[model samples]
Structure formats: C-alpha cells, structure tokens
Target: MPASLSGQLVVAISSRALFDFEAENEVFEAEDDHAYMALQQQRLDEPALPGVAFSLVKKLLAFNNGGPGSGQRVEVVVLSRNDPISGMRVFRSAAHYGLGIERGVFTRGAAPWRYLRPLSAQLFLSTNEADVRSALAAGVAAARVMPLSRQASAEHPGELRIAFDGDAVLFSDEAEQVYQRDGLAAFREHESERARQPLPAGPFKPVLEALQRLQHEPGMRIRTALVTARSAPAHERAIRTLMDWRIEVDEAMFLGGLAKGEFLREFEPDFFFDDQAGHVESAAAHVPAGQVAAGIAAG
Candidate 1:
C-alpha cells in the first residue's frame, strides 16, 4: 500500500499487448510439417491463459479508489499492443468465445488512429523495447498485459479511495438527457427539486458492489469516493444513494461546475472508470482509466 501509489504513473493495458500470446515459431524436420502447422494453429486458436491472471485484470480494473493525495495506490495498467489487423480479428471473434467485447481501442477504436499518430508503438503483440519506449513517450504509465490468468487483488490502504462522476455515471441518463436537451439552469432546477428522490442505478453499481465485497474482506484493500458535478442542494440525493447502497466511501466531492481532471490528478486513483469520453480523456492523463460503455445498461 505504501501510503500512495501516486506521485507516479498508472496504466491499464491488455495482456496480449505485453506478452506474446502466440506460441513462438519452432523449426523442425519435414516429416511432421503438417503436424507442426496444426499445432501452431491450435496454439493460436486456443491461447488460453491462466484463469487466475484473468481475474486479476478484472480486479485491477474494478479498483476505483486511488489518488495522488491518498495513501498507497498502485496505478493499474492494461497492456495492449495496437495491432490493427489482429485487434480487428480479435474483435470479430471475441463473441464466439462468449467474451464481452465492449467498445474501446480493441472494439471501436476510441483513441482514433489519428490521435495515436505521434507514437511509434508496435501495432501487434510486440512488447519490445521500442514499443514500450514509444508507449511511455505516448503517455502510457506502467503497461499491463491484459487478460490475467487468475483472480487476484491489488492491495491499497484500509481506505478504498473510490471516485466516480455524476449525471449518467451515477444516476440514470434521464437527468443527463435533460441537461443535454435543456440547459444547465433547468438541469439544476430539476435536480434541486428532485433532491429527495432516488436515482436509477448506473451501470457500475454491481461492479461497485463487487468492489465493496473486496473492501469488506478480511485483510483486504478498499476505500470509496463519489466525485460528481452535482453540488449543494442537488447533491443530497447523490449522498443518500450511497447511504442506501450501504457503501462507505472514504472521500466524496461534488465539483458542481469544476473540471474533474485537476481534481482527478489530485485524487490519483488506482483506476477510474466512466462512461463519458470527456471525463475519461481528462482523467486518463492522471490515472489509469477505463471507459465503461453505455451498452452495459441493457443488462
């Protein structure tokens, strides 16, 4: 826990991005040439990693608490090589294996190619010195090879230090849609008047519950927070929602109209997840961030 994993960079990358998932090519005599091809294909087709490691990736991504000012918090990273072709292939095939393929670099390419033009990181499973160096230069903290093999836990201070956004992230998008359709004043009035009511759950609540379980686990690491745009009279519902959930968030802030990036830099979270591009774009600069898509709401 070391008081804080901040004052340092944190990142989330894919496993294939770090290690070569495909078996190395081997040289053999011609007698079993066909067999070799089949074997290699099988390896590529089923490059199953240890389930424990896979769970670790989820655990790390699920950790929302961590900030620069907070006590020890390791920056979580998901190492992923940017192979356009292979990445494309993986996306197309992911559903066949019952894996969830949410949008992002691997799915819809959130950080468009143009945005990444400045970096020379390799496009495939090549975690070579050049790729690593380029990624660092391009602003990736510690790179993580995604898809861990087992369930794992990242230890932080007794405090879990969770952080989240307001609007669609915490409450349902009904309010946000009003804000987008109407103006700030109207949105404020609506939220202010509706302060006593409960908001519909956001996509991350179940995941938040999972984190809460981890937080309550004996000798476990957990802390929580609510970082939102709602402030003053309108923020009551948000606070009450947490209470209703029975979750103990160590630090909660209502930014009102303040920019989240600056506060996020100060917060230094282990990993921050949001559904909006603006927040994630800004927070990614200071913390390991994941953009949970809106599709999760369908569940």
Candidate 2:
C-alpha cells in the first residue's frame, strides 16, 4: 500500500513561515534570485533561527510518535517556493533544531498551494499573502503568518493551545458582511434573532475539525480557544453555533470592541488566527498570530 496522510492532522508550511529567513528574504526582495540562492547555498551548514510559528510547529510536531506522515496523529510538511539548493538549508536547519520534519516540496518560485490538495493538508501557513489567498480559495485553510509576531510561550511544553477568531474563520462571514454594511446594531440584532440557528462553517472549519480529532487521541493534550470581538447578545449566536456543531472550546472571550492583545497576552496561545488584519496585528504583539484573509472583510 502507498504511504498516506489519512487520519492525521496535516499541516503544510512555507520555509519562511517555519524559520527566520527575513534577512535572506530581503535579498530575494531585491529581485536577485541568484544572490538569494547563492546566499542560501553558502549558508547550508548554518542553521536558521526559528520564525514566529516555530514554537507552535514544534509543539504540534510533538504529537507525532514516529515522524511526519508516519501515521501519527500529526504530520507537518514543508511546502516552500525555495529552490532545491535553498531547501537543503531548510532541512538542515530543521535537523539542527531537532525537528523531525522529513517531508517537503520545493517548487522553485512557483506557487506551492496547488500541492495542498494532493497532500491532504488541513492547514497551510505561509508568509505570502497571495499563496495564502490561493489556498483559501481552493478550500484549504491557509494563514498569512505574521512574521513579526511574538513567539509562543515555552511554559506549555506539555500542552498545545490554539486560538481562533469567530467570524470568517470558524464561522462564515455572513454576520460579518452584515456588520460591515448595516453596522453593529443590525448585526447584533440579526444574530440575536437567529441565535439558535447555526452559522455556516467557514474556511478554517476543516482545520478545527482536524484539531478536534487530534484532541481525542490518547495521551494528547490540545486546548482550543475562541477569542472574538463579539459581546453579549451577539456572543450568544456564536456560542450556539459551536454548540450546534458540537465543537468544544476550552476558552471563549467575547471582547466586543476591546483590543485583543492584552487578553491574548494572558492566554499565551501557541498560535492565534483571525480573519481581520487589524485584530491579527494586535494579537501578534501578544502571541504567534496569523491572518485568515477570508470573507467580505478582506476586501
């Protein structure tokens, strides 16, 4: 039988999203691919530092007993745009960090999101907005990782805590569309009126489902939280929606219009995902964060 990633939480991440390549990225941004490739080749033996999502990736990879794609509860693969030569450094860096990431696809400047389907990836984390948008459009949950986001806390070595936004993330942007057009009062009224009705599942719903499955694995410790800007009457619908879906969240914060950074600082999630860039930017200061880039609000 062919090796498969079935029955596992598979995450595909870009090289820059996994490791700190900002300095090298600056060189690539100068429109000098040759220089970038040469730099990577020259630094092949030097391990790159961890990036924003490093801690989260490290924790998630811990769920695997064997290695990536080895029928463990989790599988993480490098789906990068770097050339094969540059990819050597990525693998070397992973090895140096004691990360058992043995699977990768080096596309040499091409969009790697196309392979997310074949790989059965539940999530795609990349620093490129276009790549993330492409993956989201293709029915894959993708996040444009905030490169400057704070690293996750090391205190939770025995547990994995993930956070998510409500609208346009775990739930569809239907309410968000109303909020954007008719204002918050109308949005709240709409949600309150249909509090018992479940909102449709959004782009990241599949990723949440994957995590839900991982939560059930023996000896696995996974904590999920929903930190949203919805408060009071509006919050009821969101809670009811989750209840309808039978998804359990360890924590829920209905902040209304308050800034999410301070609260997230207290929670110290391994990673946080939000559909709005503003919220993501704020949360980035407190935890490893990423923007979902989904729904009407993205426009």
Candidate 3:
C-alpha cells in the first residue's frame, strides 16, 4: 500500500509561520530574492528560532508518539514559497528543535496553497496573507499567523490549548455585521429572534472539526475554548450552533465586549485565532495569535 496521510490530522505551514524569519524576511522585502537566498544560504547551519505557531505545532506532533503499532496520528508539512536551497534551513531548524517534520513542498516564489488539497490539510498557516486567502478560497481552513505575537507559556508541556473567536471565525459574520452596523440593542434583539437558527459555518469550522476528532483519540491531550464578545441572548445562538453541530469546546467565555487579552493571558493557550484585527492585536500581546482574514470584519 502507498504511504498515506489518510486518517491523520495534517497541517500545512509556511517557513516564516513555523519559525522566526523576520530578519531574513526584511532582506527579501528590501533587496531581491537573490539576496534573501544568499542570506539563508549563509546561515544554513544555524537553526532559526521558533515563531508564533511553533508551540502549537510541537504539542500537536506529540500526539504521534503513541509508540510502535499506534501509527502516526498527526502530520506537519512545510509548505513554503522559498527555494529548495532555502528550505534546507527550515528542515534543519525543525530537526534542531526536535520537531519530527519530514514532509515539505518548496515552491521558490510560487503560491504553495495549491498543495493543501493533495495533502488533505485541515489547517494552513502562513505569514503571507495572500497564501492564506488563497487557501481559504480553495476551501481549506487557513489563518495568517501573527509573526510577532507573544510566545505561548511553557508551563503546560504535555497539553495543547487553543482558543478561537465566534463570529467571523467559527461561524459566519452575518451577526457580526448587524452588531457593527446597528447598536448593541438591535444586535441582541436580532440574535434573540434567531436563537433557534444555527449560524452558518465559517472558514475555521473544518479545522475545529478536525481538532474535535483528534481530541477523541486516546492519549491525545487537547483543550479548546470559545472566547467571543457576544453576551447573554447573543451567546445563546453561538452555543446552540455548536450544540447543533455536536461539537463541544472545553470552555466558553462570552465577554460581552470585554478586552480578551487578560482572559487569554490566564488561559495560556498555545495559540489563539480571531477574525478582527483589534482582537488579534490584543491577544497577540499575551499569547501566540493568528488572524482569520475572512468575512465582513476582515474587509
């Protein structure tokens, strides 16, 4: 039988998203590709530092260590735009950090999101917005990783914690637009009236489902939280939607417009995902953060 990623949770991440390449990226932006390639070649032996999603990827990969006959339950592939030569450093870096990432697709400068389908990736994370948007358009769960976001706490080495916003992320932004246009009262009334109706799925729904599946596997230690700004009546719809999907998150925080940073700081998630730039900015200050640039708020 052919070696396959079937029955495995696959994640496709760009080199920049997986490691700190800001300085190298600066050269790529200011100079030409040749200069950037030269820099990467110069430091080929030096392993790059971990970036925002590093902890999340590391913890998720730990699920594969169920021993001999257990088989691999997770796969992390480097889906980068760097040339094959530059990709050498990426693989080296992963090895240096003890990450067992062995698969990759180096596209030089071409879009790498095209490979997500073949990989059966439930998640695609990159520092490049264009790549993320392309992956989303292709029906893959994608998020633009906040490269400078705060690193996750090292306190919980054995557990993986992830948090996500509700509207525009786990669910469609239909209700979010109403809140943005009208006042709070109108938004609450609208949500109350539509409480029975489940919100439409958002781009992150597929990834959430994949995580839900992973959580059920023996020896997998994963915790998920829904941290949304909706309160009271509005919260009912979001809860109902999850109930309707038969998905259960470990925790749910309906902040009712409270700043999410402090709450997330205490939660200490390996990564947090939100659609609004403001929320991402706040969470990035306290935890590793990624932005889902989809829906009306993203516009």
lDDT of 1 at 124: 17
lDDT of 2 by residue, 1-299 (tens): 98988877889999999999999999999868899999999999999999988988887887775345445777889999999999999999999988879899999999999999999998999999999999999999999999999989988887889999999999999999999999999999999999999999999888888788777665348899999999999999999888988888999999998999889999989999998889998999889999999999875
Residue-by-residue lDDT tens digits, candidate 3, 1-299: 87799988899999998999999999999998999999999999999999889999999898888767777888999999999989999999999999999999999999999999999998999999999888888888889999999999998887889999999899999998998899789999999999999999998888788888878665558889999999998999999999999999999999998999999999999999998889999999999998888888886
Evaluate all candidate structures by whole-model CA lDDT and list the values in order.
0.47, 0.90, 0.92
Model 2 segments more than 4 A misplaced: 66-71
Where does candidate 1 have its weakest 10-residue lDDT segment?
Answer: 142-151
Rank all candidate structures by their lDDT, best first, as comma-separated numbers. 3, 2, 1
In the predicted model 2, the residue pairs found to clash are none
For 43-84, candidate 1 gives per-residue lDDT tens digits of: 455534322123333334333333343442223333333334
Candidate 1 — which residues are off by over 4 angstroms?
1-161, 295-299
Model 2 lDDT-worst window of ten: 62-71
Instruction: Note the residue pairs that clash in candidate 3.
Output: none
